[model samples]
Target: MSPRRSVADTLETRQRILERSLAIASAEGLEGLTIGRLADELGMSKAGLLGHFGTKEGLQLAVVDEAAAVFSREVPERVKQAPSGLRHLRAVCEAWVSYLEREVLPGGCFFTAATTEFDGRDGRVRDALAGMNALWRRDLRIHIRRAMSFGELPGDTDVDQLIYEIVGIMLALNHFLQLEHDAAAPARARKAIRRLLGG
Candidate 1:
């Protein structure tokens, strides 16, 4: 193969590995990932897999990054055209619930699974998950503050508290859908959000 063809092939292979890793991690948790298992599942040799990511930790980190990209594409990116303030906030939240309702990941929310899997741990993986979650919270805060400025929300609203409650709704929605398989979970979450926002 030409040099350009070789480089393209390498990129394609890496993408394949990351895609498989995301699916497996979503369903089984990042801790459940193993080089041997991935190699066997993908029909790639252990050496070849290792070549893509020198260590298991490296692979896990890459998977976390990929998961973040997927979340951005599915949630926030979907609402980019919505006007900021309460309208954007509502659009983003609805997109988030829809992402989970559609079962974008086989295990439901990838971050929820990762958070539960690594919340108690200390390492790069845990730190990466925390950082991603923090960024998400920050976006919510911006929208909440903007809504306040527009008088859509009470000026006295505690932004952090509101964010906490909103996040709670999503967490509960994930739990209900994943554990109890509740079909009404999404509607319940949307209703609760609307009530909280005083709509």
Candidate 2:
């Protein structure tokens, strides 16, 4: 009979592998994430790593899922206390910028990395990433709608456009910070969002 690995032990190992993979990817990009590299970093054998995740794609998917959970937990809480409107909008942008500015994903954002990495590729990864992007858009739109309802924005505002602009602002801030960590992109993003909302 095979020796049994406790469920808790299995989960801890999986979490470590996922976190290590994210750290590697964040530092070296997605292409740098390999079972061999992960095994080496984790002080485990390749076979042991493969026992946890059967393939590279499997590990990538798990990392994405973990990133998603982190995003969900971190982003919304920052804005929860703000009144719904320009403040809420600003808070959301600030929160997103903070999330990246702090390097929560180690690689900036796994979504940004995956989208840039696998956008043209045809497969499960691309599809899953596309869905995640869609979900983000939806969530941002909901906040925009709320802000609009609060009369914090122009009644003619388009949620779709606002969401895209906010995302662009985040991307701009991310790279700007990456290039010059001394530069305050989050504050700039807040300023730009204020101007956009006519605040």
Candidate 3:
């Protein structure tokens, strides 16, 4: 038998596998991720791949987890660098749109593709996606709440309704960029956001 691998080696291999899997899932959907294909792509045996992820669902879940990690670093963490309150909320919107515009993934955004893929399907996949979405929405709400606390926004502002509108606008931004191929979508999104938040 081959010599035993170190802990670091194992972690590296798993990270590599998840990175490749995320790319495939981003461009094509989790349905397109297959054991045989991943093994072939990685130049590893199917059995070897199975050693890392016992099931395809497990691999998909891992991919979703990594995607969220990437999104957190790229968007939320970056936005939080701004001073809290209305400025923070605006920063969040700008960073979010910039993340989409930067093409971090072939799918524009991993969650966007995953959401469309698993929206109607009930399973661990949908649950995982929903959890990420909740965190993201919660972040937005927190920033809005901060704005109210800082006196940047009126205390009477309807947080839920404001979140609904902002989220809808971001969805439209993704739709326009991906489906409509609208070059102006990002600019229009920022404009709409400023109008919504009265920036």
Candidate 4:
């Protein structure tokens, strides 16, 4: 007879499935995830997997939510523990490159890959990514403003332009690391950030 699973076991099984799905989705875009593919990969039947997520969109949404949680834990949560304002902002930028360095997502930054995949598509997937992007931007800007409050940056700093530059550097860093497999991408990013911060 098959072994019986307790409530905790069932929950753990679901989490395991989601984690594996996250890894796959990290490498393959969400569109690459399908019920049949996941079911086969997880050794579960299509109907059994669909029991967890009613449809492909539902599964994609869950994966996006999980990705956001991972990013928050790895990036923003760690940044928050640093000194506030510009220090936090600096950490914010550094933590991102660090994330890519560690290959937290097998395909590089999940959001970066997702953005490229969904930027022009309109749907719940796009909404979810847009929401996460907005949250990151808000956090970055708040830190920059706080740094100004702490006199770390000039009072006249063009907040928008500064954020633009930081984000641009981060995008380039990801490209260098993911596309070119450059070992110095993170260091180059830090150097750029230091120059931008005037220190």
Candidate 5:
């Protein structure tokens, strides 16, 4: 029998299940995630697991939010730890590459999977993913603007264009890392970022 869980313990258990669910979704896509599979993975009863998620949509939404929170917490912290301007921009690029390479999601990057999974779908999941993408793009714009202010980048640089370029680099690097064993992509990305930032 499972040990008796206090109210707080139960909440913590639910959090763990949600985190694991995201990882599983990342690894196998959302279609492969189910309450029964999660219960088996966690060594709990299906009914008990269902009690936490209630529905598949509920579980999917929770995973999307969790993935966003994870990115917000990790990437900025790494960037902030670096010197401002060009160095910070480089650090942010490195942090992004490292995050994808780390395989925080078993399938790959959470956004990468989500965009492919729900991009054209009209519903809560698509909205959630879109919002997450918007937020990240905004954050990147802020950094790019700061870089400009510091004279580390061109004065006439378009934030949107820079963001698009950076996103493309990140996506390319992610796919290369996922398909090949080469670490060259990250270095290549750093070089590209340096060129754009005028390092």
Candidate 6:
């Protein structure tokens, strides 16, 4: 292959690896990603996989990054056109619900599974997950503050508490949809959100 073609091939292979890794991690937790298993699954050599990522932790971190990118595309990016403050907040939440409902990953939310898997552990993977979760919470806080300023929400609204409840609704939606196989969970979640926002 020409040098440019070789580079393109390498990029394609790396993307394929990360895509498969994200799916497996979403369903089975990051602990389930073994190089040998991936190699067998992809019909690639273990060394080739290792070359793509220098170590298992490296691969896990890369998968986490890919998951974050996917989330950005599915949720926040989809809501970018909404006017800021309450409208943006509502749009993003609906986008989140839709993303989960659509089953973007074979499993439910990748972060939900990852956080459960690594919450007790200490490592780069856990830190990366935590950072992403924190950023999400922070984004919610920003929207809440904006809504308050715009008088969409009461001035005395408990920002942290509202965020907690909103996140709780999404978590419950994921559980109901995935574990209980509840088809109405998304509607219920939207109802709860509207109730909380008084919309």
- Candidate 2 per-residue C-alpha lDDT over 16-46 given as tens digits, one digit per residue, 9 for 90 to 100: 9887887776656667887777888889999
Worst 10 residues of 2 by lDDT: 1-10
Question: Candidate 3 — what's its lDDT?
Answer: 0.89
Which residue pairs in model 3 clash with each other?
A: none
Q: What CA RMSD would candidate 4 show?
A: 2.3
Provide TM-scores for the models.
0.97, 0.88, 0.93, 0.92, 0.89, 0.98
Greater lDDT among 2 and 5 belongs to 5
Best by TM-score: 6
**Candidate 6: what lDDT?**
0.96
Candidate 5 residue spans exceeding 4 A from truth: 1-5
Worst 10 residues of 4 by lDDT: 1-10
**75-177 in candidate 4: lDDT tens per residue?**
8888778888777787777888788889988888788888899999999999999998888788778888999999999999998899789889988888898
Off by over 4 Å in 2: 1-5, 81-86, 180-182
- The residue-level lDDT of candidate 3 at 142 comes to 94
Instruction: Give candidate 5's error at residue 85 in angstroms.
Output: 3.5
- Model 1 scores a TM of 0.97
Which should have the higher TM-score, number 5 or number 6?
Answer: 6
* Model 3 alpha-carbon miss at residue 54, Å: 1.0
Query: How far out, in Å, is residue 126 in model 6?
Result: 0.8
Number of the top lDDT candidate: 6
lDDT per residue (tens digit) for residues 1-199 in model 6? 8999999999999999999999999999999999999999999999999999999999999999999999999999999999999999999899999999999999999999999999999989999999999999999999999999999999999999999999999999999998999999999999998998766
The residue-by-residue lDDT of candidate 3 on 5-120, one tens digit each, is: 67678789899999899988988988899999999999999998989989999999999999999888888888666888999899888898998888787777788888999999
- Using lDDT as the measure, name the better of candidate 4 and candidate 5: 4
Clash-forming residue pairs, model 6: none
lDDT of 5: 0.81
